[model samples]
Target: MNNSSKAVVSFIVGAAVGVAVGYFLNSDKKDELVGKLRYQADKLKDKWKKKKDQFEDALENELA
Candidate 1:
């Protein structure tokens, strides 16, 4: 898939997984659950950031 399509899929999948994890951990070990969710979120954030930077660099190179 294209980069944009891949990014969207990644976000949607990450959100769904986060929601499921939250639902399952709503009752017990809330702190642990939140930590796990945060970790996953950070990972996704990093992935998106990298992709965005790559796209920006390519655009800049094309414009130069």
Candidate 2:
């Protein structure tokens, strides 16, 4: 297989392993886990937004 095909196969296998691990080690504190994950995701979103704005501002400054 080519590079693209190899990458796709690797991703599928990794995803399958991750699912199996999550299934077997199911956490009892489901709500808490989900909440923490959501909180982290929001924080990441904020960081990305800040970086995007900075990049846009720098580009505008360079042009002007």
Question: Which numbered prediction scores highest in TM-score against the true structure?
Answer: 2
For each candidate, how many residue pairs have backbone atoms clashing (under 3 Å)?
Answer: 0, 0
Writing each residue's lDDT as its tens digit, candidate 2 over 1-64 gives 9999999999999999999779756866777878899999999999999999999999999999
Whole-model lDDT, model 2: 0.93
Alpha carbon lDDT at 16, candidate 1: 100
Relative to the true structure, candidate 2 has a C-alpha RMSD (angstroms) of 7.7
**CA shift of 6, model 1, Å:** 40
State the lDDT of candidate 1 residue by residue for 13-53, as single tens digits: 99999998887777677888789999999999999999999
TM-score of 2: 0.58
Off by over 4 Å in 2: 1-28
Total colliding residue pairs, candidate 2: 0
